[model samples]
Target: MSQKPSKSTAPEAENAAATRGTRLFLGLSCFLAGAAMMIIEICAYRLLAPFFGNSVYTWTALIGVILIAFSAGGYLGGHLADRKMALDLLGWLLSGSAVLTFFIPALHTVFAAGLSAQGLIAGPVIISLLLFAVPGILLGAVSPAAVRFYSLTLKDTHVGAAAGTISMLGSLGSFVGTFLSGFFLLSTFGVRSIFFGTAALLLVLAVAAFLLAKNTLRQQAPVILSGLFAFFMSWMTAPKPKPGVIFEHESFYHHIEVSERTDGDVTRRVLQLDSTMEGGMDAKTGDLILPYQQYWKLALLREPAKVGSALFIGAGAFGMPENVSREFPEAAVDVVEIDPQVIEVGRKFFKLDEHPRVKAHAGDARRYLLQSGGKKWDMIFGDAYNGIRQIPPHLATQEFYQQIADHLEPKGVFIMNIIAAITGPKAELTSGMLATVRKVFPHVEVFAVGYRRDETQNVILMASREDLKPLIQDRYVQQGSWQESLIKTHVPKGTVPHASYVFTDDHNPVDAIIARGLLE
Candidate 1:
């Protein structure tokens, strides 16, 4: 109590406290900035899915463009740090990034529609760059700037150690962000809400950063104004359904939309997943309007006892399964649709819950089949499609067909509805699928549902261990209607040449094939 500390020592202690505060602030800033960057990247996929489709090509474009943006950001950030490593500058960067990010949802549909018209490869790349490149650059700059601040704040600490620690924290934050956003955010919060939440977090980070730097209100005015402008603009410009769209939802698997259109005398309700027409039904009669639905009727011609139980891999609009339940009251029908939301939509809009004989199971078709154990089906229908009428890669593989064969009864028929052209580059998908299915089933035949040679059409592939001609001939005689005429007109009489590539669990180029087909 007798002696007083020296002025120099007291000042040194104060400096130490101030440095510690700066380090803490910068560390938290870097961590959060990194987290925000990754969250936006993951959300970008969902945002783009409605237009570009969530495919390998879309992801490739996103990842590649984001990496390039990061590299440029890091380079520029390092250069700026060497010249003027100020917290206020970092604050501006974060604030600007937050503003741009907030605008993403508002601009998505507009940009997507405009760019997608260019084709898939160029479309996603250009759109990703337009939507995310600026923010990625701004966020990437945060890391190097953070390193500079840490080095300056902790003069006693080794520069290399400080840099390593800061970078590691950023990476750790990224890891957490990736898992949290993918697992929790997408499921818990809607896509637009997630973007809004991300922007809010960034805004908070920017404010804290600017306050720590002791910035004046006047100096912070522009950032505040920009953020406000972005928020209001985004709120005003958020996407809305087109005039006739009665309902729309962002499911974990797809951007589903239901719309109504009126013809001369009848109205039709259509179910669209992303950009592909999944199914349609007559509004008044509830009759399936898609031609593929009519073809599924052939399953009735399989073994009489075999037709007692059947499975449908995809349940779009529940059209075929509901029809089966209604037409064959004795038959037990099980439908597996991967998206639960789609099932909900089906029940709410398509009357999926009204059928007692049809049981809806929500899960991957392949996984459901594998887990079914000894449960066999008389007829298995595979109508699962992804993107713009492309079969899911896993469901189109040789191993998956083997699973189908195992789950089928002795004379069970496997009817698959796939979209591809009959004769052109697009026919590769048809040939490849046929080749894969042939590996497991002894007899296979192709029927062009639309009978279009130049345009992409729904090509039905029917395979069975037993000959199907007898069933077709029998049904032809019984029905003696359009079903007979369709078979004769659209069904291919000769075998198709084997495609250059076979789809397998290990190697599947279905996305690339579809992209080329769509581009052409």
Candidate 2:
């Protein structure tokens, strides 16, 4: 028989079990920190979106700040870990991150709005740094602290195994976080709620860390309870909607709000997405209040002999589609609004009525045009502006314009609402759009809705197969009512110079161009 195997003593076995427990707890803490870090990074976009827009600049700033924080944290965390071997180091790092995470939602509006007013480019960077950097650093500190703690608890001196195992767990947690947040958390919950959830998860891990350090429950109760209280208070104290904000929601694509504004004789309900006032309706009468809604009637003025059907890319509560339904009783008006919630708001608050001719679909405008299977419309309205300076990239491409042209009847007209400076160094946006649209349509006419030529404001671009020069000229010279006067005065006699570079699906920078124009 082999030499009699000696059974391990109770103390030795207990020590082994305790080591396993410590390692497991440290691993769990790291995994959670990794998940929380990703959740915070992803949701940071939504927080900044309402003020700065979800632009490339916003993303660039978030990613850059987060990475730098991680680098600094890793360096500092390694130093702290070398100096101390206590499990509470990882706990405190997570605890600090949790506190900062709770502070985010309360501070986002104040930081984003105040910073954005200063400079668009710098605003995103500064806000990202102010809001996310400390939390990121604290979270990032978890990895090195965890690895060191894990190494200390290991019975075998395989340092690489300990580090690799911890890193793998953290990475696995990151994968789960990316999938979970993108597929579910964002769509299923609001931004602040997501923030609070993340904070709670982190605080729990901090408690676990303390417990794993062999600290009695009594020792950590005060600290853990304080965090719970902070989380609760933050949730309770979140800002309420402003005075006239009757409806506010965080849609998948936008931070949408329907608010009322009154000025002496005028009162209106405005649909706001992020920082842009998409459209408005009179508070009492529910008539269209945006000047563009009225200006877009230039299509009706040209009045395709028979408009059997029409498509409006983005229908807000302007009552334009309803107007089209009534104005042209024979026309079948289809409204494609991307956000379904916006449609609900229109129905609930803005008095969108049901008409047999006016049907609404909640989906992408481009996909609608593509899947229409050569179905033609007499009039196509392009009023889909998704951001302050960011128009959906797919919509601004040459391919999309061609699709619009292809889906129109021979006498069909396409009217697009563009916000750009009509004349000045900042006119590149209008020039680029003209160049791109001209590629698909032989004739295009532009009317300035904004009185100031150099001011960045609404400019209507109209395109069709048949030239409406005589009709345009007729409207230009003759004036009677305010509507006619608007047509007569704003239509430029000469066309803008087309940009040398065209916008194709593969390569388009409309968002950057617009932002640059706005800034410069």
TM-score of each: 0.94, 0.92
Q: What overall lDDT, based on C-alpha atoms, would model 1 receive against the true structure?
A: 0.82
Q: In TM-score terms, which candidate is top?
A: 1
The 10 consecutive residues of candidate 2 with the worst lDDT sum are 474-483
**Model 1 Cα displacement at 53 (Å)?**
1.6
User: Which digits, one per residue and each the tens of the lDDT, describe model 1 over residues 314-420?
Assistant: 88888888877777788899999998888888888887777878899999998898789999988889888863534678988999999999998887889988888
lDDT of 2 by residue, 1-520 (tens): 6886557677788999998888888788778888888889888888888777767777888999999998889888999999988988887888888888987887774566678775557788899889999999988889988888888777448789988998999888888787888878887899999999899889888888887777888888876777777677677767678888988888777888889989766688888887788888777766677777876576666654456788999976747777777677878888999988888878877667655678888999889877779899888989888544678878888999999999898888999988887788678888899889989998888888777787778878889988767666754544576557556545563556558988998999887886787687
Error of 2 at 216 (Å): 4.1
Among residues 3 or more apart in sequence or in different chains, the pairs in candidate 1 whose N, CA or C atoms overlap within 3 Å are none
Q: What value does the lDDT take at residue 429 in candidate 1? A: 77
Question: For model 1, what is the alpha-carbon lDDT of residue 507?
Answer: 94
Which portions of model 1 miss their true places by more than 4 Å?
8-13, 262-267, 283-285, 303-306, 387-389, 473-482, 495-497
**How much is 101 displaced in model 2, in angstroms?**
0.6
